[model samples]
Target: MNRFDAIIIGAGPAGLTTALVLAQAGKEVVVLERGEYPGSKNMFGGVLYSKGLHELIPHFWDKAPVERPVARWVISALDKEASFSLDYKNARYTEAPYNAFTVLRSKFDSWYARQAEAAGATLLTETIVEDFIYDQQRVVGVKTGREDGELYADVVVAADGVNSLAARKGVIKKDLSPDDVSLGVKEILAMPAESINRAFSLTGNEGAAYTFVGAATQGIPGGGFIYTNKDKLSIGIVVKLSSLSKTGRRPEDLLEDFKQHPMIWPLIKEGEIREYLAHLIPEGGQTSSKSLYKGGLLATGDAGGFTLSTGFRVEGANLAIMSGMAAAETIKRSSRSRDFSEKGLSIYPDLLRQYGVLADMEKFRHAPNFLKNPRLYQSYPELVCQISNALFSVEPGPKKGIGEMVKEARKGKQLSRFEIIKDIYAGWRGLA
Candidate 1:
């Protein structure tokens, strides 16, 4: 009874998607999750891109417990007391077939797991996978913390997350370096739906997503985010793990500081804190993992380092969904002749490419390194704010030209013309 056609570790978006696909194809699949239930330990910035979930369950927003459809995107650069923002809103995004929706992972993942279960996959919750059960060098199953712990299968899928024991035990990837990951701390704040609408300038179910840099992280090489939900807000900051350690500041302390920022405080002043969460995010870009698969094992989601973090945005769930679909496709193809070797699973990368997961990651491979430039989080924002203040102030003797304002802002900052040009060029190359 413990033996199955396939075994999947973790029950996040990635593993559940893989199980859903394979189960629909008539494959016997079992998913093991260590949390009290699916999504119990999961957290994110709250936006779920439509393309991925739509492919799995067409028009999923109709059935899923999503919070709100994102209708506006705002990116703000902040100084100590000033903020410059670029806000974009599209009426089309609020309609059906939307671009993306805000989701509470705890509720969404539970609903998603049920979809997999309804499709004939078995879900075992509160079950920790101790290690992989190997035959020769090929992964066959997992050893769980159950009475009869050993469960065998033809193939094992590791979707256990950034610190995936399945991936490490199966030798699919090595340990993550501090520089390759990021630390994210978040809080869910509850407010009235009407208040949310008025504050963010949204109607009905429309929501807004905001990202902040510069003083948002106190000039740290990281940023803050706020995603509007139906009656709540998801607010957080993500920082480079290596840089965070060097600062001797607590992630929670940073979050407190962000909440008290002049621009952020007003919006969240009436909100009541409902939940606090912290998680490690993979931001290593192309260098996060050494391999995606080995022998009979395949890594997907954060386990495979499939996340993409450009300075302006961070995406993981959509990539996880796509990677999961690719893993399922690879397994189906390999099962045709019963070859689960590393060579047999070589098609996994190609499948990921075909699904557009790897392609997206590859495109932003240099983003991680580019975001490490301290000037982006510190000097640039201060300069821009100073220039803006000078341009808009009425006390100035005579209105100065934009050039004079820029040169004045550059004074005492020690920034050179060539340095500014080089940084602009680098930004174009890395983010454009």
Candidate 2:
């Protein structure tokens, strides 16, 4: 049984960042990934915030496998035949330390793992950690699936993705209900870079991130996303597991429908699907985040439910990197004091709070609940689209006033003013 100072499970951003930090600090760190290689099984709708990564590797865009800087963000409300969009563009985001970048996880995670290796971290692929090795009450290491696969370590960092078995090994409460989890299905559609730039009205390395609500998911409590990735487009739909079950529609079917939407078809009309991938996302905010550290074990990234899925954007990659670094910093401090106990690792969560991760989670804790309202995803979009159509339609009749148009739009709609007011108040309070 080989031993190390730290054993990190999973080689995604969280685990690799932790390994990179700890190894760079001169500590013996080993990262075990169940995939054939890092990011082999990982998938995301693309987009990696640069703040955390910039802190890890300054000027990361110069070295990272970034596809494009996201300078345009579009949020769309889709109806059956019409869609309304809010577009925001900032030229400043095209410069250094940009807001975020589109990335392919398979390529990006591999690059990130290499960075960890260059920092002296050991990476073991095709190694599935079966369970944890416990010295009475404290975790000492992990037992892999390999023959005689017990590898000891002073501390265990569980960076396993959502539905992490590492976090379930008595380190923290792992009761993740279907309501707290989201199933994301995505496709990489191959398209020429110039065609994509022309399609999105973008120039150079600028990319567009479009998020869709309402008809995208057929009123399911979820949304669709599109990110430009150089020669391809990362498009996907994320739906709440519980709500999806009630829809009686497959996620793939929803994705196909979303692609056929008028707003979506024009963007990827002739593109060929290069890859289809599905993954689970932790949608639970602070309410679902249990203890982050216990005994000699610590949980980071999605494993600890350190993800936030606001309607406008789903943010977890940056938090994962931050949590991983926080865990590494805590381990470094603990090593200096020769303490590897739960109390010693308690500083990890504090560091998360200090880095604005936990604070963001707490602040957005109401987002998931706020998003549960069906009207926001269904009737509301249709209403807004109909209103826009009514206001803009150049018919052969006298134009109606704004109030008359609104009243006409509400004629057949079942929604009442009281319901709208109540929902508005609730949404405001929930998001406030």
lDDT by residue for model 2 (1-432), tens: 499999999999999999999999999999999999899989877989899999989999999899999999999999997899999999999999799999999899999999999999999999999888889788898999988899999999989988787655545766578887889999999999998998888998899999999999999988999999899999999998999998799999999999998889999876799999999988866743337777888888888787777777678889899999888988999999978888777777778888878888888777778888888898888888988998888988788888887777777667888988988887886677
lDDT of the structure predicted as candidate 2: 0.88
For candidate 2, the TM-score is: 0.97
lDDT of each: 0.90, 0.88
Q: Which residue runs of candidate 2 sit more than 4 Å off their true CA positions?
A: 167-171, 287-290, 396-398, 411-413
Candidate 1 per-residue C-alpha lDDT over 229-281 given as tens digits, one digit per residue, 9 for 90 to 100: 99999999988899899989899999999999999998888899999999999
**Model 2: how far residue 136 lies from native, Å:** 1.8
TM-score to true structure, per model: 0.98, 0.97
Best by lDDT: 1
